[model samples]
Target chain A: MTKNPIVNGKLVCVALNDSEQFNAMQAEFAEAPYKGAPTQPVLYFKPHNTWSTDGAVVEWAEGADSMVVGASLAVVFGKECCRVSQAEALDYVEGYTLVHDFSLVEQNYYRPDIKGKCLDTTAPIGAEVVSIADPQALTVITSVNGTVVNETPVSQLVRGVAELISTISYIMTLQPGDVIAVGFPGQRAPVAKGDNVSSVIDGVTKLNNVLGN
Target chain B: MKHARVLFNGSTLDVTVEDSFSETGQLKSKADGQLINEADVTWLSPIAEPGTIFALGLNYADHAAELAFAPPTEPLVFLKGANTLTGHKENSYRPDNIEFQHYECELVAVIGKEGKNISREDAMDYISGYTVCNDFAIRDYLENYYRPNLRVKSRDSLCPIGPWLIDKDDVGDISDLKLTTHVNGELTQEGTTADIIFDLPFLVEYLSKIMTLKPGDMIATGTPKGLKDMQPGDTVVCEIEKVGALVTNIVSEQEFYGDKY
Candidate 1:
């Protein structure tokens, strides 16, 4: 099956923003030889194998208590971009969409836990891509079993869409159709087997999926 | 002079060019041996559809010393997303408020055949050709997590590799070549393949033992020590002796939205 038609031959990049909440979550590492927040965004790639669509049943790995939801918004590139100025970066976006970045609760924050983050069917992105007037002001509401769990404002994002495009462009060219997940902020909610999870990003898209035992 | 993938007729074609890399070139199609117009297309990364880009960290003894890390007995391998790969003449960016963003000049080995449990003796046979790569790093993003975090090394378009791919047979003894980097007109980084701690064949053999090495996979051998920050409008050239000169320009800070929270 195709992962996402628009994402074929395109990259799916995840940004590990050194946000205030991320720093707070990492306070456990504040002992001697403390390594603080990274000066910039740490990035990782979720191979196409991790991609899933709405209504797909993602198999929960055996023995894991719960999977965490990576509630995020992705910016789709509408045109080829390189070294784009932040002022004009937003112009490169085709639209915004929601993603259910599902993964096992991560214990290691320094290096990407390949087993936790790289499992198949870990990422479920919304199909309908929609243009947004202001991505920075949007709200993402995540619910488990019809109960509201977490609501985050796009403003909590350390870097907005424009800055993300420009900053990422500095390193590589952003091609049309490439999707950059702005990042999942704070500690995410725990999802378990047989749970119906939904992440709603108003005006953009909503992603629904079921975790299978 | 050798093999390259150029944009032609709206599609990227694997072609062997007849002109020297320094001059405007022509395409000799590998599929049908038809010569097509090279002027209408753009240059894409030599390994256009690569699986995983395995890069080395501090693979050179002196470079390790420069960074204050002990030389690793084994390869310091890291995976860069496909977004990091850009073609020659493409730009590498240095963002605002970043203290140090530098370029690393290294030799790239493109795997031609797939193999697992590959031995050191058969490693060279799996390599199709060699190319030059500029593994640019934004040091400000350095976090202890994955020592050289993706933000520091794997940012979009940070790795500019290729002008042309010189067949492995064309590039003499890998260890004998000189690898140098020039920012604009000034020579800054100077090193030799001789300094590479885990040499080409060993790197391939080592990597294959862990995972299958597929065709079109790239193993970027570590860069030599000399590194310096680049500015906007500066042209960064990575020249591998007997290989090809991979040229890239450094542009000014691309603006980002919002006050960095």
Candidate 2:
């Protein structure tokens, strides 16, 4: 197994960045607790302890029967970015990699999902970061135990790569090598213990991990 | 002993603070026996490179009630990026468009050991020291999705931590410490660590159960009630008993970054 490409940086993940996911939760968002749709990007952090290399076994939280797993195209920043306009946002991109974002099934969106998303080894990234011509043109496919589960196009994002970096950097500076997972699209594939999950961004990178323990 | 990192003579230096020296205090450089007044040096966050920064929200019953919500059964933990961290005596920008920006006086526990699934009984042994931080929140930017989103809490320089890290041994009982916030030298927010719904040991065990608690990782325990809106030029001091007082100056965006922002 290769070393995780992300060594000394934070993994900032945007929730509900997928258009389908946003639309699906739009009704609930308008109800009490939410009141309205999110004006700014819903952000959360997957700390370093959660980071693992591809092919590593991710242990499930005690008593957790299943988990939601999805593949995201993660943009790695090459420079310290702060307050850059959307037009120039891609210039700071170092390259891209695939990240397996695993989370315990969560129904609440009003509070930060720390316990659900921040479990150790929950996030596994591809070994390499390869430069891409157009991030939005890519398609990510997730396979569970050799069966195709979900295929998502990067263009289906509510906030594209550049816009996410632009808006996030406007609030907090992203250091060199920092990652922004553009977010998974549609519904994620549910995986049980011992299931081998693979996510591939053809010609870019592939991350494969198995659920265990 | 209180450990600190400061900028002196155009270089960063590790120093041991001597609180008994004078009113302004003094620090002795570890490299050499150079003693310098605290006012002459720029204080950096005590931990040079902090790992994951876990911040609790509404961990106090009074604070939970103030927001008109019931005290959370589980700790409302949120992660903060390194960009949000400034140092003692630093300026935290309060955006001109925002109406209510408040300061949260928190007792920050610095993790000294790496562990996972650490039991509450052995949790305190993993702590290296304690510090203080002002977790500034811009109420205007708060959205429901991930309520208290990064925009509202993790803005650049929004979290000011340190002055120094007082070793856990130096501070006797972690609980029962007084946490006070004074804005412009007037006492505004005051509470004791005894009021912390999820105390340090409980938080350590709770967080470590989900993820590995690494050395340099910090947990900013939630503040109590009495949150008051801070304006530009307001000098907010968040002090915890035994741990040092973290002072932050609230500056407007225009003043903090000028037209660059």
Candidate 3:
């Protein structure tokens, strides 16, 4: 399948706050919104230049050996959707796909460092989108060199598809082709160069990529 | 006069010069000088392709004080996506289950010429024109992950920019203009560009050093204090003296999301 070329499309990413796992990490913030269980979804972005598709190869800069891989599910919008209710959110979704949110793991999680996240070919999404009514029932698996490194149930996502669509639409409109990554439930360890990285959402779509220079 | 892109005949977007504003606005075709009825068309962000939106945080002393942060000696730069860019008169969404979703009326500097290492004096020349914008913030989406998180700042249509672009030559002395934001006819925020810690030319010069400023790239300098939350159906009028007024409609998540189910 021919991969979708990202022509300056918006790639929105969310943060996972699995209560038992994320609580302690979130405790460091004493601020109003950050202190409590996130009243709103924590979000970030991977710009168009960072977008790639299956069979793509991502190169690491000099002195940079390994990068973090966030294997997750992406909700692709069928049409323009805005301020949609959770009950009707899924109606606007076209289908489900796979995404590898590549980043250079950094100790500072306080703020998003673009250099660490937004790199050319860093985000490789599945070329094909599969229709799925219930996304949370699926499992997302990541492998490096054919060895399973991380795997989690989509149900573990802090905010499900409907809620994520409803919450995000409150600010802007999501058009056809715009993708919102539901997020990975756990930590994404680092994978070094010359490794084959693959992310698969059981029975939905699988993505393969090679880490290079 | 200012340039604007309006939805002509429902689907076609054509450039027009906003001639004047009244209950029923007036516009002239930029290509053929034909008159257009403002009500007959929809508004779009004056600059269609705003490449790499570079925003500033705490560039104003009053805003820094309001947020309980120390005034930074240097500009805090962050990137926002183009999806957040919506035209004037458009509605911005405020999700349910959160407080502190506020409006930040800002002066937008549109880059006209592409340049790197732009000098402070020549920086002003690189700017094409000025426009008004409401940098709506969903503080509920605020996280330590980023000062202006994508959820908080870059949500679709969160940044309502432009009724039209006021040519740089039309607006003299960019540093002394007055910025006022009215919510439902009540003036909630009022400040002068003079209060800005970093001036426009300095910002362009500062940013151009880090990255190239291309034509149509917008620098949303920063916002002032007097921040407050808005509700659904509320009308936000953001006006920059000498520049035009940019009106935005606010809708609740439920209302905007529609009851399709």
Candidate 4:
């Protein structure tokens, strides 16, 4: 059995990196609280406690009726990267994997969704990391109980894989083994207790987890 | 007992701080009992490998009112990455062209035991020790999305924690401890831990119910009112009544990054 690729690193996630999601929320971004679309990447951290390997059982947070599951391509860094250019960003990547990013349903993005997103075992990573020639051309498919519920193309990302590493590395250094989940599509699949959730990065890897409690 | 991690003689060592020390004498290595000079060694955050860093925003009623907002009914919490942490006597950069950057003196509770669904009554049992941190914020990067966004709160070297970790038993009665911040030898911010809207036990219980709390996880229990703008060349000392004082220097981006900026 292959080891979980993100066991030793911190998981940093990008929000609204999907072009479809960014465009869908464009009008709301101009309204009262936001006043404008994000000029830079929206980032959040999935701490170690939230990390789990494939085939794990994830428990629901208290009173949580359902969860929004997002399928994403995980970029594993191989080098200490800081302020690298987009052209050289991919050179620092170790490989790619799949991740099922789970969160409770939230209405607004005004505050950091800690309670909704940082639940234990909510982020299940693929068993192994595999090299891919072009991460931008890949597609992610999420399923519930063996049935496909949502599909998104990596081409729809507002900032491609290389650009995300470049932009984020300029703000904070990315050490070896660090994982970045290059955002998720606007549409996501909802999973309930006792359901099997699986996310796959087309031909690369698959992550499976069972929702419980 | 107070514990610390420091870089002495080109290697990291776990050391314990003695109750009595001269101005120059500081730490004693646990391995060899060798006395080390404070100025000769580089200080590091007490916890060598921290798990998750949870920070609170607007957890103080006075601070919420200072920012012209009502106190949150629920805890306004956020997660910070490890890159933001710097050790005592370190330099936290003041990004160029930013109008407002401030220091937040906060009490940090370090979790010692792994727990899920931890109750408030048992929260005290989970804490291993206490430390002080200066949670700095660059107000210019504030955005509505994730209001206290990572850009503003989690910038590299933005959070400076530790002088040492004091065992909880040594620092009794956390309910009304005094928290203060001094900038350039002038006392500028002051408040009591009693002003914190959501106390430590409440935070531990609330967060653990959402996710498991692992050993080395730290919770920065928010700051109070009296925030003042900090500029380059300012030396800020954040001290809690029983906890140790953590000192940090504010330097310009050029000074912090040197030729890289």
- Per-model TM-score versus the true fold: 0.70, 0.97, 0.78, 0.96
- Residue A185 lDDT in model 1? 57
Whole-model Cα lDDT of every candidate shown, in order: 0.77, 0.88, 0.78, 0.88
Please give the lDDT score at residue B96 for candidate 2: 81
- Which wins on TM-score, candidate 1 or candidate 2? 2
Stretches of model 4 off by over 4 angstroms after superposition = A1-5, B22-24
- Per residue, candidate 2 scores C-alpha lDDT tens digits across B1-261 of 999899998999999987675565778999997888877899999998799999999999899999998999889888888888889899999888778999999999999998988999999899999999889999999888787788888888999999889999999897799989999999999999898999988998888878888999999999999989988889999989888788899888878776657
lDDT of 4 at B185: 91
TM-score of the first chain alone, every candidate: 0.90, 0.95, 0.90, 0.95
- In angstroms, give how far residue B221 of model 3 lies from its true place: 2.0
Q: Which parts of model 2 have CA positions greater than 4 angstroms off?
A: A1-3
Angstrom error of the Cα, residue A142, model 4: value is: 1.7
Q: Give the alpha carbon lDDT tens digit for every residue of B187-256 in model 3.
A: 9999988889988889887776544567877888888889999888899999999998999999876565
Task: For candidate 2, report its TM-score.
Answer: 0.97
Clashes of 1: 11
Q: Is 1 or 2 the stronger prediction by DockQ? A: 2
- The window of 10 residues in a row where model 2 chain B has the poorest summed lDDT is B18-27
Clashing pairs in 4: none
Cα lDDT of model 1 by residue, A150-206, tens digit: 887878777777788887776666788778888785667898889999888864689
Q: Candidate 2 lDDT, tens digit per residue, A110-164?
A: 8899889988888898788889989999999999999999888999999999899
Clashes of each: 11, 0, 6, 0
